[model samples]
Target: MWVDLVVEEILREAPSHRHVVNDAKTPSGHIHVGALRGVLLHDCVTRGLRDAGADVEYIYGFDDYDPMDDLPVYLPRDYERYLGVPFCNVPAPEGGGESYARYYAQEFIDVFTRLGATPGVYWTSDLYRSGRFNEAIRIALDRAQEIREIDREIRGSRGLEGRYPLHVICQQCGRIGTTAVVAWDGREVEYECRPDLVRWAQGCGHRGRTAPFDGHAKLPYRVEWAAKWFVLGVTVEGAGKDHFTRGGTHDVASAFCTRIFGARVPHPIPYEFFLYGGKKMSSSRAVGAFARDLAEAMRPELLRFLMVRPHPRKQIDFDPAGDTIPRLYDEYDRAAEAAQGEAEDRDLARTFYFSRVAGDPPRGFRPRFSKVAFLIQMPTVDARRVLERDKGAPYTAEDERELEQRISDARRWLERFALPPARFTLQAELPEAARALTDAQRQFLRRLAEIVQAEAWEGEPLHTRIHELKEEMGLTPREAFGAIYLIVLGKDSGPQAGWFLATLDREFVMRRLREASAAPASAGE
Candidate 1:
C-alpha cells in the first residue's frame, strides 16, 4: 500500500511519465545487508510503476572508480598500500584478473538477483572509460566557479575560490584519492598528489597536467551524483536520510543539477537506515551481516519479505542470534495465509503480494515454523509424517515443497543462530538439573507420565491436559513446564511441550518422565 502511494506521488510530480529509478553503491568491501534496503526500495517503486501502466526502467550502478580510502579489516594489513588507489585499479583479494571492485560487487549482485530484482547494471569505471561522461566532465570544468558558489551558498563554506570540483589520478603514483585539481584550462587541468591529503592514504607528491576527460578524472561525489542523473536520465532516486538532511549532499547536488548541468532534478525519496544491533551498517567496516551470507541463510521470498514489508521511512533492526529468524518466519506465514483469504486485512494482503518473488502465493497446507524446527531435531521423529498428520490430509506437491524449504530454513537457523530455548536435544539420561526439582514438580511429572501412557493423544488435547494438571497441582506454569523441559531438553523452556512430546517416541517420553520423577534429589534440595 505504501508502494502504491509512492507510485502515485511519482506519477504526479515526475517531469515525465517514462522514468528511470536509480540507485548505486561503492563496493569497498563485502557489501553489508543494509544496502539491500535501497536496492529493494527502488525495485518496489519500479514494480509499482509498471503495474500502474507507466514505462519505467530500473538501473543500478557500481561506483567502482571510487578510491579505496579505508582498508577493510578482513583484508591483509599489506593492503593499506592500495588505499589511495581507485578500486578499479586494485587487484582482487583472491588474485584473479578481476578488479577489487568487481570481485566484491559480483557477490552483492548475485544476492539481489536471487531476491528477484534484475536491474540493468552499470559500472562507473566503464562510464568514464567509454567517454560516456566526457561532455558532462567538460561542462563541470567550464562551470567550476559557479559550482563553487552553489556549494558555498548551500553549505556556508567559502574557503574554496579556485579549486576545481574534480580529482585526477596521479600520473606517477596512480592514486586518485590524494589528487586534487588546482586549475582547469579549457582542455587540461593542473593537479597535485599531496603527501598529507588524507589520513587514510599518503600521497606521493606527484604533480601533472592532463585533459580531464575520457577516464582521466572524476567529479567529487556531490557533482558526480548530479552528473549521473543528467547522463542517465534518472527521474526517480532515493537515498539514506543522511544525504537528505538540511544543507546535506542532496541539497547541494540539486542546485548543481539545475544551475550547472541545466537538467531537471530527479524526484527525491529520503529513507531511514537499516541498522544491526541499533547501529547503522557499513560496507567497508564489516559492521553487519554481509548480503551474501544473509541470502544464503534465508529463503529468497522470506528475505524479500523482510525488506518489502517495512516502509522505507521505518528503520529495521535485525539480530540473528535470538528469536528474530523464527518470528520473521511466523510473520511471513501469517501474511501468506492472509493473502489467500478475501476477508483478511487488505494491508497484510498487499504485503504478501509484493513480498512474492514470482507467481502467485502458493495455496496449500502451511506448517508453523517453530514446530518444524523442533520436529527436525528429534532424531526418532519423521518431520514429514508429523507435519502431514497435522495437516489432516495427504500431502500435495506444493505442500511437500513448502515443507522441505521450511526444513532447510529451520536447520540453518538452528545450526547458526538459534538461541538456547529454541534449540533442543533430547537427553539420553535423566538430566542433573531435573534432580533439583521440588517434590511438587516430581508429583506433576509422575501424573504426566500416567496421562501419556493412558492413551495416544494429539498435540492440542495433550496440551490441554498438561495445563489442567498444572492447575490441579497448584504449580506455577514455570514449575510445571520447567520440570518437563529439564527432563527432556535439559533447558528451562522449549516448543509447546504437548506437540514436542507427541513427535517423540511414546516409550521414550514415558521413560524420561518416570526417570525424572524418581531420580534422587540433589543434596541441597
Candidate 2:
C-alpha cells in the first residue's frame, strides 16, 4: 500500500497540488541500483494517483551543484579542473553522455521511459540560476539559530570535530552558503576556482579557513526540496527503504517543509532492493548489472516488465532464467486475459500489472515484449565469429545481407551492455522430453548446421529449410520442434528450437553443446 506520510504532509504543509521529489547526490559515484529502485517506486506511486483520478505533477530534481571532497588526488587526473566547482558546473561527459549526475539521472529516466513514466526534470543549477529557489532558502536562514543547533546536534550524534559548513553549494554561482542568508540578502553568489587546492590531495587551500556563513554559501538542501515540492506540486514520490527509517533525512525534510516552507511533501512510498543473479544489484563494488547492459542482452521491453510489474514495496531477486522473466509477463498476460473474462479481482490485478484501462494508454505506460525473452529465443552465437567470419552463412546473397544487419545490431547492444558468462552448463541427467529426440532429429541438427554454415549464418533460408526438414521426417511440427530444444537447452521445453538455433552461429552452439555434454552431473561452479 502507498504510504500516507507524503500525502498527509502535503495536505497540512504544502496544501497545494504542486510538489517535487528531490533525489540529491552526496559526492558519491554515479547512480546505481539504488537510483533505479527509487525511480521505480516513485513512478508507481505517481501512476497509482493518476489511476485513482488525482492530477499530480511529479517533478524530479538533480542536485548537481555540490563540491568535491578532500579525496581529489584519488580521482582521475581531470579532477583538478572540476574538483572545487559545484558538481553541476562540472562539464558533461564528452562524446554525448551526461555529467555524472545527469548520466545517472538519465539512466533512471531510461528505466522510467521504458515503463512509460514522464516526470519533468529541473536541475538544481538551473533552478538557482533562475532565482526561483531562494524563498525556501530565506525560511531556512530565519531558523539559522535552529539550524546551528541542528548541526551541533548532528555533530554530537556523529562524534564529529569542531564545526561543519552550515550552507551548501549554489550550483548557479558555485558559492557555498546557507539557504537562510541567501533568502534575505538577495545577492547572487560569486564563484572562484581553487585550482591549487584542486592540485593538493590534502585539502582545498581554503578547507580549514574560516569562510563566513554567507547565505549564498549554504543552500537549504531542504529549502530547495521545499521549493521543488511547492513549484512542481508532485503528488507522489518513492524513496529507498533506508530513507524512511525513523529520524532519517526524510523525517527532517518533512518537518522543514511543514515548519519552514508552510507546505507538505508529496505521497512518499518506500521500496526494497532488487537482487540480480542471486546478489543485490550494486555498482559500488562495481558488481551488478546495468539497465543498458540488460537491454542489450535482451530487449528493453522485457526489462521494463521486470521493473514495473512488481509492487513498489516488494523486493525483486531477478534471475534471467528460472522462468522469472516470463513468469512476470505471464502473470501480466493472465491478468489482461482475465480482465476480459469475468474473473474475480481480475480488473484489480490487471490494473496493477498493466494499466487500469484496456485501450491504448499513454506511451509512458504501455507494455512490450521483453528483451530477456528475445535473448532466450535468439540463437546463441560466438559474437566474435559472427562479426569476423569472412565466409557468410549458407543463404542467398540477399538473405545474407539482411541477417548481417540484425547481427550487427545485436552485437552493438551486447557490447554496450550484457556480460556473457565464461561458462555454459549442459544438464547431465537430461529431461525426459529432451531424451526423446528421434534419429531424424539428429539428422536434422546436422542438416541444419550444414545449411547454416553454407549460408554464412543468414536467417531466412535457414527458417525455410527447417519446415522442409519437418515434412521430410514425417514428424508432426511439434515433434520435429522438440529436437532443437533437446539439443540446445538439454531440456524438451524452451522457445522455438529452430529460431533459437538460427540466431546463433555454428561455432557458439557447437562449443556450448560440447561444454554441456562434457560436464559431470554438475555444471560450472
Pick out the ten consecutive residues of candidate 2 with the lowest summed lDDT.
361-370
Candidate 2 lDDT over residue span 118-175, tens digit each: 6676677666666566555555555655554553453333311222213444333343
Error of 1 at 24 (Å): 0.2
lDDT of 1 by residue, 15-45 (tens): 3579999999998989999999899889988
TM-score of 2: 0.57
The residue-level lDDT of candidate 1 at 427 comes to 85
Model 1, position 116: C-alpha lDDT score: 85
lDDT of 1: 0.88
Off by over 4 Å in 2: 1-30, 68-77, 80-84, 95-100, 107-111, 150-202, 207-227, 230-235, 278-285, 298-301, 321-323, 339-348, 351-525
